[model samples]
Target: MSRFLFISCLCTLLLACQHSPKKNYFYLSPISEKTVTQTSSNVSSQLIGIGPVDIAEYLTSSQIIDNQSDNTLTMSDNAYWAEPLDKSIARVVSLNLTQLNNGRSFVNFPWRSDSKPHYSLRLHVDTLSRTGKNANINATWELIDNDAKKSILRRNFLRSIPAESGAKGLAYAYSQLLAELSKEMDEALNQNP
Candidate 1:
């Protein structure tokens, strides 16, 4: 009878494991596919050094965070970023910025030792809030001239976009927000850089 009970429990556990849903993984993709044509007259492809991006402490995790209520935040263990979230943002932002520039040189931060960037861009993400079907990113970015020690431009950009409802949709919203930021940065670079 003990043997029979053990077999039944083992079968139950195996069946339960088998019936569990598979975990889903997601990644953020660049907004630009291959190349961004130089259509905007002010666009310059000068090498821009972007890096050391700072993310909010709460958002610095693999799990996608969702604010279910004013005091409740939900994190999905099953839905995770394929890579670190901060690194992914850098890649996506680079893709967007490259298109805005007329030059072909865009470099991520911690660049080659000998490389000299035209402008150094830094970003601090204040909030990447996904409250409901809508998502938004509130970030502040600054640009500095490589040759000069003075600050070139600083601004806060906030954009809201539609999110699908899951990880995939959230990624879509983030991509859109990055594209908006790219456009703004392009304008800043063109103004006097």
Candidate 2:
């Protein structure tokens, strides 16, 4: 009967599909490298100060909230194409500071100062989120006068990064962002007396 033949063919097809091995693939595109811009060799030796950044205690476990809603995606899940909110950003900030100071002197936070410094830096990273085609980094940089207990310099730095599709792409974007931040910091410090 045609009905019997049709049922038999369906069962054979189902069995074949069930027996087929499942396949998983990860596609990563080639990431383009960006070059660092060279700045003038002239730099001041004034020892600037800095307080600890108030980043999330468990950055790796943190997530970025959706722009449309309060929904957050864990850094782990986002790691498929990019880095999470972990130590990577912190490390980038540290490197920027070191490079800015020219590696001569950098005082750690929880500072036990014997004397007042020329200027103290306090940073608050309010948001570091990723949108559809861009990553948004918003931060407040404050330069406090140790003796005055008041801010001498304050600026908000916001960077918009083109969305990266892969892990390498994410890294490349962060690197570029860090470089821009460093430039901004340098200019801020230079304007200070």
Give each model's clash number.
3, 0
Per-residue lDDT tens digits of candidate 2, residues 58-123?
A: 333333333321555434234332334433454455456556445224454556757446676777
Cα error of candidate 2 at position 120, Å: 1.8
In angstroms, what RMSD does candidate 2 have relative to the true structure? Answer: 9.5
Estimate, for each residue in 34-145, the C-alpha lDDT of model 1 and write its tens digit. Answer: 5455554434445678876889888877878754458577987588788887888888888777666646466888788788787788889988878777888999999978
Give the root-mean-square deviation of each candidate in angstroms: 3.1, 9.5
Query: What residue runs in model 2 are displaced by over 4 Å at the alpha carbon?
Result: 1-44, 56-70, 78-91, 100-104
Candidate 2's TM-score reads: 0.60
| Candidate number with greatest lDDT | 1
RMSD (Cα, Å) of candidate 1? Answer: 3.1
Report the C-alpha displacement of residue 20, candidate 1, in angstroms.
4.6
